[model samples]
Target: MAQGQSDPSCRRSPPPGGRSLRQRYSGDHLQRILLVRGLLKLLLVVAVLAGATAAGWQPATAWWAARNRPKFDTLAAEQGDVIEVINSTGTIEPVQSVQVGAFVSGPIVGLHADFNGEVKEGDLLAEIDPRTYRAVVARDKAALAARRAELERGAARLQQARREEDRSNALAERNVASISESDLDQAHFTRVGMEAEIVMAEAAIEQAEANLDTSEANLGYTKILAPVAGIIIDRKVELGQTLAAQFQTPELFVIAPDMRREMRIFASVDEADIGQIRLAQESGKSVQFSVDAYPGEVFEGKIAQIRLASTTTQNVVTYPVVLSTPNPELKLLPGMTAEISFQVDRRDGVIKVPNAALRFYPVRDHVREADRVILDGTALEADDQARGESPSASAKAEAEGERKRRHVWVVEADGLLRGIPVTSGIGDHRATEIVSGDVEPGQRLVVGVAPKDD
Candidate 1:
């Protein structure tokens, strides 16, 4: 071979120890495809991871929340007294009150009684000006004395006329006197006239005596007296006070009779509770009350009367009830406000439960699946529920339709919730008596859930 020249067959069609261009190009394209496929697989893996995270987050959170549930508060059933009471506000006052008034128009001159002073029947309370009445009485007495004198004089004249008439008649009959028959008739007529004059004088005397009596009564009216034995609660008339009694009698004083011995409480009971109060009154049930003035003390009273007259205020009707209480210590005063309680029913040594337990309502998850229907407000037949036709039964009252079926929650041994049905009879604000149920004393019942920590 010549220099820088090679034979055609021995020459390298492709460079020695190097691949062909086609093969290099093919290898580069294959590497590119493999990189793209690897990138696609990484993207698919990321999408799958995102989907799994999104799908698992909610369930995981729910499981954690269920694990960390709220704590519950509980109360135990106990044996105690359950009293149903009717509360009312009342005012203390006297049992009977009387108003003393002025009968005659006069100026008050003397005050014999003061406020809160005790007075007996016919006791002097005040005195009015008696000068004008005294003068009228004297005038009437003088007129009566003059009438009596006139009556005596007329009687003497009548007797004289009668004697003259007798003498004239005798003389005429004997025919010895020189008098005419006409003179004898005149004497008889004079006697008759004198007798009429005597009668007129006697009538005048009686009239004067009546006038004197009227004047004396007027004089006695000047001294004011008490008609009943009581304490003077109010003294309206003071010294030098003028009272005019022309149209209506002006009230001078107000008296409360027997106030120290007894006091009455006037309470307004709601119409809704009137039936219960009436029944209690018929049974002679006692009432308990407390006053703001005497905070720690309680006063007992009995129902005295229930007035038929009802008073309506703001579209609410109420009846007045009068309660009588002894006030020997005089601690209760008039116008004091009393907080009264009327016990309609009472249960002693009965299985009682807290009212909070009955009022508690739980979420669906806390209760069993079967009982969850109860919380859903699914109506069940009263008869079937009371007869225990279903596996779960309600109280006996549910059968009679007198009461509604109710359930209370109790914690089971496996940390699950169980329901108990009970019939309630009498109840107070805090507790209630269980009439019929599977409850017993010292049984713990769930009342409410405690708040979660912040």
Candidate 2:
């Protein structure tokens, strides 16, 4: 046999299943190629799905946006009262108050007045210990009596000296008396000395009388009296309480004269509001106020005084504005807090705009390009910085001249925003007075974008 040819017996035969080993291996390799093709098909399907999803996203978002378009918040311009006011909290006090105190140092022996008690002028409010004062008065009286007795004795002595001097003169004239010339001179000197002593005694009596009067006055002071007819709002002294008035008068009571008739609210108004307060006073506008004690009860007052003195606290200056209100009911008490409103100006049936409308800022895209210049304050700043420019001096001057001119937004029928210039007057927290503007009553003014709901 040649090397290239094999014997018939050496060649292998097919298996009983009629499949050779080469054929079986060929089948397995074909199955693997088919499985690889199936995996490629799966990957292609996944890629197609991803592409489809990406392509549909924008349309889905558009449909949702069309369905839930942004609605704007709006307010209507109308005719109403535009009231400008300055509000503040103030402490209520009596229009006039008197402080009663002890002039003499002594223990409080009796209390004749009570807190919140009504009193008249000269009514005894309290009493100090009178025993010591009475003793002083008695001593002063005795001293005065002694001075009078001394004065009487001195007068009698002066009369006797005068008579002695007369006797000496008679003896000298008759030239038959035992008295010598030196004795006559001594008598005259004694009479003169007696007269001087009598004068001194009279002065001592007057001094003693003054001392007695002072003692009596002090005794009277022991009984504390109300200086004016009023209600006792406070009492500082209790029975048996000692008061030391050596340095200063010890405050014993506080009386408010005719507090029921009128109560004053000392409101600290900002200096910025002082001018308006003066204007309100000149205009005869009544101030509206209420107290915590009567939350629902409103009280009316007039500007009584606007003090020139200003109080400074933390770089803020405030002037004291005194508001006088009639409190015939006596419901407003001292130290009660009052919420007051000083109406600076009031205009009725005037075109007014909502404050929100004035403060609203519109989206840049929502506004027209020409009106986008006044879209929002922050945007305006950014726009200015980008342009490297600022408002011109003439523009600023024009804006200042147009004191009430401001820019506001309105929605056209096409659902886009357009800014229109408006002239405003006095305003309050809720609305501003429209002096002149293209806007009319009942016209809807865009405030802001309404919130989207889920």
What tens-digit string does per-residue lDDT give for candidate 2 at 40-91?
9999999999999899999998888766766789999989899899999999
After superposition, the stretches of candidate 2 with alpha carbons farther than 4 Å from their true spots are: 1-65, 176-179, 376-403
Give the runs in model 1 whose Cα sits over 4 Å from its true position. Answer: 1-63, 67-71, 175-189, 363-366, 376-401, 411-417
Candidates' C-alpha lDDT: 0.88, 0.89
Return the TM-score for candidate 1, rounded to 2 decimals: 0.78
Q: Give the per-residue lDDT of model 1 (tens digit) for 45-101.
A: 999999999999999998877668656799999998888999999999998889999
For candidate 2, the TM-score is 0.81
State residue 153's C-alpha deviation in candidate 1, in Å: 1.8
Q: Which candidate has the top score in lDDT?
A: 2
Range of the 10 consecutive residues with the lowest summed lDDT in candidate 2: 373-382
Q: How accurate is candidate 2 locally (lDDT)?
A: 0.89
C-alpha lDDT (0 to 100) for residue 59 of candidate 2: 100
